[model samples]
Structure formats: structure tokens, C-alpha cells
Target: MSCWDTIADYGLRSLGYGERLLPRSDFTLCQQVVLIGSGMLWNIYFGTLALIAGFVMATAVAMGKAARNPVIAKISAWFIFIFRGSPLFIQFFFAYFLFLSLKNAVPFFTVLTSAWAGALVVLFLNTAAYSGEIFYGALQSVPKGEAEAADAYGFGGWKKFRKITWPTMLRLAWPAYTNEAIFLFHATTLVFFSGFPAQSQRGDALYYANYFADKTFNPFVPYPVLAGYFILLTLVIIGLFGLINRRLNRHLPQERRSRMQMRMPVLR
Candidate 1:
């Protein structure tokens, strides 16, 4: 089959639309590319949904942290500390076990044992905490003059915060937010590792890459193909986030505003 045919046949195979069975023997580069590209859909799903959802939660956590109220501030602080202090790998393991135990304790908790529900929960919380910390620092640096300027314009409380404080915080927090976004994408590889079974042999890019490596006793081909796919994914993510960063910094001087630049990839 032509490469286009191979891709079309298996591109969305993870959702079970194409070839009924994966290539078992005589694994070719065509099979690997098609299957792994199909797996990329799952990575994009997890990363995009988690990051978009986490954006709001992170803002709330950061705003709560910067609030004058001690109780609200403390809760935000502790949540951020708890998630940030530990390795996400440990968190995923612990979360899986905790969900498993919860299922044992309460029969109604089976949903948490399902990877779709459980892994998303873990990632949602994890990214929220990390992004919250980034935003909190940015909020703190929003400048007293900006706050006073809000007051001078007869703005107070939520109005001042919603308009001035939030925008500025986002502007200052954006580069780091982009970092959090990329980190979250890398973290998507951990979904199957965290007790979330790949139902029906359906797995993410890494999971399939690992499978090929094991079956063929060849890591060189499969792993590097996975890497190339991920590099492409990363570039796309940067391009998307770069648009947002531009909008966020639109009002600032070019030299002072942060541009989205590639940095070290964060592997979970």
C-alpha cells in the first residue's frame, strides 16, 4: 500500500475506524508511522483538553492565593505546594492506587478506575497546581502602580481585578504558562503508566512505540519515529500558544514583552 493509503487506513485507528487488527509480523516503517500517528490523536486530546481546562482553574488558584483573605490564600498555597513538591510520576501511581482503593471502598467509584476519568483528573489537578504557581508569581509582580491606577479610575474590587489585574498577570505569566502547556503535553505520555490500562490495546504514541521496540527487539526505529512525531507536536503547540502570547503582550513595548521561545522540554 502507498504511504497515503497506510496513513488513511490507520490514521484514526485508535478510535477503531480503520484496520481491525494491527500489523502483527513483518512490521514495516509504513505500519509504524501510521499506527504511531494514529496514537498522536490521543496525545493531542489529553494535552489540549487538560491545558484549556487548567487555564481557568490556574487563574482562580492564583487569584485566591493573591487575595487579602488569609484562609483563601492558605488553601491555594497548600494545594500548589502539594502538587509541585512531588514527582508527577509518583502522583500518577499514588492516584491510581488511591482510585483503586476507593473503588474497593465504594462500589460507585468505578468511574475513577477508568483511565479516561482517572488520568484526566490527575492531569487536571497537576497542571492546575503548576500553572497556579506560575500565575501567583506573576500576580505578585503586577505592580503597585497598576493597582493604584485602577483605583484612580474609580475601579475597585472585582472590576479592577477582572480588567487590570488579570490581564497583567496573564501577560507576565504567559511565557511560564507556555512552559506549563508544553510540560503538560509531555506528561500525556504517562497516562498509560499511571494504572490507566490501554483498553483494547489502544495506547498513546509512546505506548505503541514501546510495544514495537519490544516486539521487534529494535528501539532505534520506533523510538526515534515517536520522537519526531512529538517534536512536530511540540512545534505545533508552540505555534498555537505563540498566537495567544502575542495577543497577551499586544499592548506592551516589543523589547519589554515576552515572546514565546522554545526552552528545555520538561519530561515527566
Candidate 2:
């Protein structure tokens, strides 16, 4: 096939369109790019959904962790500790088996064996834990003076939190939150590697990249393409977050607004 024909055939292959079987031998640059790019759809879906859903839960979790009630605080702390203290790779395995065990009793959980449901849930919970910790620290760091001022005007309870607390916490947490988001996107690469089945080879960017590498016995080509795709994805994330960061700090003077920087997670 010509380059354009190859692109047309495999462009959306990851979504089960156009090409049915992947190139088995004599891989070309066009095949590598098209197939890998198609695979990116899963990564984007996993990351975007997890981040959106995780943000809401993370906010609640942060509040719970910061609550005056010791029981609430302990529950939140335990959740965070369990998810964060262990590696996410382990979480996927444990969660999959946990779901498997529950599936016999709760048939609804049978779907968890698939990367779509199970891996997404794991990523959602994992990101929520990481982002929750960031939000919790920001919540605690909310200026006491802001609280006192709200109190002077009789703001308290939900009123004080809604009007005076949440926005400030978001503004403060956003930078680190952005970092967490980038890391979470990077983490999506790990999903197929976990116990969850990719099912028909429909997988994320790294999955197809790995497939090509294995088939061609040439890591140099496919891996760099994968890396380039991720770099672009990272830049897109930074741009989107930069817009939000701008809005978060809109009220502050330019000098006071924090600049957004793309940072990689520190691996141990």
C-alpha cells in the first residue's frame, strides 16, 4: 500500500475501523505513525475521564481529610494512604482480583476484567488519591485570614466553604494538580501491562508502540515515535491547564500569578 493508503487503512485501527489486521512484517513509517496515533485515542479517553471524575471526588476527599471530625479525617487518610503508599501497578492487580472475587457474588463486576472498565476505575481512583492529597494540602494552607474575614461577615459552614474556601484551594492546588494530571496521562501507558486484557489488541499508544517494537525487533523507530506523541500530548495538557491556571489567578496581579511549568513526576 502507498503511504496515504496505509494511513487511510490503519488511521483509526485502534477504534476497530478501516484496517482489521495490523501489519505483521515489513513495517513502514506510515504504519507506525498511523497505528500508534490511533492507539492514542484510548490514552486520551482514560486520562480525560479519570481527571474529570477524579477532580470532583478529589475535592470531596480533600475536604474529608481536612474536616474537624476525626472519623472523617481518618477515613480519608486511610484511603489516600492505601492508594498512594503502594505502586499503582500493584493496585491494578489487586483491584482486578478483588473484582474477580466479587464478580461471583456481584455479576456487575465481571466487566472489571476488561481494561475499559477495570483499568479506568483503577486509574480514576489512583488519580483521585494523588490529586486529593494535593488538594488537602492546599485546603490546609488556605489563609486563616481569609477564613476569619469570611467569619466577620458571618460566613461559616457550607457558606464559608463555597464562597471563600473552594476557589482559593483550587487556585493554590492547580499547579501541582497539573503535574498530577500529566503523570496520570503517563500512567495510562501502564494499564494494558497490568492484568487487564487489551482484548483484540485494541490498546493505548504504548501498546501499539510495544507491538511494533516486538515485531520489528527495532525499538529505535517505534519508541521514538511513541515518545514524540507523548511529548505533544504533554504540551497539549500544559496548554489547557495554562488556560485554567490563568483563570484561577485572574484576580491576582500578573506578578502574583504563578507560571505554569511542565514537570515530570519524580520516580523513586
Candidate 3:
């Protein structure tokens, strides 16, 4: 088949839209690229939904960690510790089986046994814990002078937090949060690799790349294509986050604004 035909046939195979059977022999470069790109739809699905849900949860978690009440503070702290302290791979392993058990007991949890739901819950909690810590640190680091200034203006409670505290906390936390967002997207590849099975052979980008590698007995081609797709994805993330970063710092002088620097974690 021509490249265009390959595109038409497999462009959305990962979503179960086009040809159901994967190419068995005489694999062409077009098939590899199109099928792999098709699989990226799942990566985008997991990452986008998890990140959006995590952002709201992370905000609540940060506030809980910083609350005046000891009970709330301790609960939040332990939540962060448990998720952050364990390896994510182990979390996925445990979560899948845990959900499976729940599914057996409660019919409502049947949906959670699937990778789409089960894997998403794992990613959502994981990113929320990490980001909650980041936001908590930023909350603490909010300049005391800013708080005092708010007090001077007779701002108190919700109004003060909304106008003064929250914006400043976001400004301070955004650079690090951008990094977390990037990492979250990268982590989506782990979904199918974990205990959660990809439904009906509709797997993510890494899943298809692994297939091609196993069939061709050549890791060099398909793996690199997968990497290339992720690299492009990373660039798109950086560009979009950079725009938000600039918006956050717009009120400040250029030199005084916090610039986003992408720093890879030494260990994660």
C-alpha cells in the first residue's frame, strides 16, 4: 500500500476506528509512523485528563497541607509522602490489582478495572501529590511582605486570599509546575506497560512501538519514531506553558520576572 493508503488505514487504528488487524509482515516506514502516531491519541487522552483533574486536586491538597488544623495538615502530608515516596511503577501494579478486587466485590467499580479508568486514576493521584507539594512550598514561600500589605489594605479571609495570596502563590509555583506538567505527559507511556491491560489491543504509542520492535527484531527504527513523537510533544508543552509563564509574570519588569527553566529531576 502507498503511504497515503497506510495513513487512511491505520491513522486511527489505536482508537479502533480503522483496520483492526496490525500489519504482520513486510512492514513499511509509513505503517510504523502512522500507526504509532495513531496510538498517540491515547497518550494525549491520559495526560490531558489526568493533568486537568490533578490541578484542582493539587490546589486542595496544598491548602490542606498548609492548614492551621493539625489533623488536616497531617493527612495532607501523609498523602504526599505515600505517593511521592513509592516508585510509580509499583503504584500502577498495586492499583490495577486493587481495582480488580474492588470490581469483583462492587459492580460499580467494574469500569475502574480497565486501563482507561484505572490507569487514569493512578496518574491523577500521582501528579496531584507531586504538584501539591510544589504548591505548598510556593504557598509558604509567598513573601511575608505581600501578606502584610494585604492586611494593611484591610483585606482578610476569602477576599484577601483570592486577590492577593492565590495569585502570588501561582506566580511563585508556576515554573516548577510547568516541569511537573511535562513529566506527567511523559508518564502516560507507563499506563499500558503497567498491570492494566490495553483494551482490545488498542494501546498507546509505546505499545505500538514495542510491537513493531518485536516483529522486526529491530529496535532502532520504531523506538526512535516513538521518541521523535514524544520530543515533538514535549516541545508543544513547553511552548504552551511558556505563554502562561509570561502571562503570570507580565506585571513585573522583565529582569525581575521568574523565567522558566526546564530542569530534569535528578531522580523521579
Candidate 4:
């Protein structure tokens, strides 16, 4: 079959619409790309939803930690520290079990049993903690000069923060936020590995890729396919973030604004 045919036959296989079963024999490059690309839908679903949800929560946590009150600040600080300090793998496992146990106390909350809900929740919190720290750091690093300028313009409290502090934090943290986003996309692979089972084998890209490798006993094909897909996804993310960073910096003279740069995340 042509690559297009393979894709047409299996592109929506994860949702069980095309081909009742995945290709069991005669694996071709077309089949690998089609199947893995199909599986990427789930990864994108999780990553995109979690990212949108996480950013709002992250900003709140960062602002809370940056607050003047010691009580709220300390709690937010501990939250960021603990989540950032722990391995995401462990967090997934722990979250899955905690959700499982929740069945006893709240049987109606069955959403926790599914990867869509359970995994997304964990991912949201995980990204929030990481992003929270980045925002907090940016908050601290917001220049005193900006605040002084805002004061001269009679912008104080809510006005000062709205006009300056928030935007500056976003700009400073954009690069790190990009890294967080890339890692979160990659991290979606761990959903099936953790306690949340892949119902009907409807798994993420890594999950199906692993399936193909094990069935054929050839890691070379499926693994590289996954890596390529993820790399491409990362590039798309880079471009999107770059666009946003440019818009964020649009107000400044070209020299005064920092250039957006990519850095490999050491933590991940």
C-alpha cells in the first residue's frame, strides 16, 4: 500500500474506527508512521488540554507564592518545591493509586479511573508546579526599574501588576515554559505505564510504538518513528511559542527585549 493508503486505513485506529486490529504482520515504514502518527492524537489531546488547564493554575500558584503574606507564600513554596523535587514517574504512580483509593470514598467520581481524567489531572498539577517555579523566578526577577516607571505613571497595586509585572513574568518564563511544554508532551507517554490502564489498547504514541517493537522484536523501527514524531511535535511547539514570545516583546525596542532562546531541560 502507499503511505497514504496505510494512513487512510489506520489513521483513526486508536479510536477503533479503522481496521479492527493493528497490523500484526508485514510491517512497513508506511504502517509504522501511520500507526504512530495516529496514536499521537491522544498525546496531543492530553498535552494540549493539560497545558491550557495548567497555565492558569500555575500562574495562581506563582502569584500566591510571590505574595506578601507568609502563610500563603510558605504553602505555595512547599507545593512547588515538592512537586519539582520529585520524579514525574513517581508522581504518576502515586497519583494513580490515590485516585484508585478515591473510589472507596467517592464512587461517583469515576473520571479518576480513566486516563483522560486521572492522567490529565496529574499532568496538570505536575506542569503547574514546574511552571509555577518558573513564574515565581520571573516574578522576582522583574526589574525594580519597571516598578519605578509604573509608579511614576501612577500605576500601583493591581494596576502596576496588570500593566507590567504579569507581562514581564510571562516574557521571562516563556523559554522555560516552552521546555516545560515539550517535556509534558513527552511525559504523556507515562500515562499508560502508570496505574491507569489503556482501555482497549487505546494508548499514546509510546505505548503503541512499544507494542509494535515487542510484536516484531525490532526496536529500531518503531522507536525511531516515535522519536521523529515527537521531535517534529517539539519543533511545532517551538514555532508556536516563538510567535507568542515575539508578540509579548512587541512593545519593546528590539535591543531592550531579550531574544527567545531554546535550552535543553536538565531536570527532565
Question: Per-model C-alpha lDDT, please?
Answer: 0.86, 0.90, 0.92, 0.88
Task: Order the numbered candidates by lDDT, best leading.
Answer: 3, 2, 4, 1
Model 1 lDDT per residue over 8-41, tens place: 8888887778887777798899889879888888
Better of 1 and 4 by lDDT: 4
- TM-scores of the candidates are 0.93, 0.96, 0.97, 0.95
Please report how far candidate 2 places residue 62 from its true position, in Å: 0.7
lDDT of 4 by residue, 51-131 (tens): 999999999999999989999999999999888988888988888888778878999657887888988988999899989
User: Which regions of candidate 4 deviate over 4 angstroms?
Assistant: 1-3
Worst 10 residues of 2 by lDDT: 259-268
Instruction: Tell me the TM-score of model 1.
Output: 0.93
- Pairs that collide, model 1: none
Ranking the candidates on TM-score from highest down gives: 3, 2, 4, 1
Off by over 4 Å in 1: 105-107, 253-256, 261-268
Instruction: Tell me the lDDT of model 2 at 54.
Output: 97
Which is the leading candidate under TM-score? Answer: 3
Q: Which model is ahead, 1 or 4, in terms of TM-score?
A: 4
Give the clashing residue pairs of candidate 3, or none: none
Per-residue error for 253 in candidate 3, Å, reads 1.8
Can you give the lDDT of residue 88 in candidate 2?
Answer: 92
Q: CA lDDT of 7 in candidate 3? A: 93
152-251: candidate 3 lDDT, tens digit per residue: 9999999999999988999988878888988888899998998999877899999999999999999999999999999999999989989988998899
When 1 and 2 are scored with TM-score, the better candidate is 2
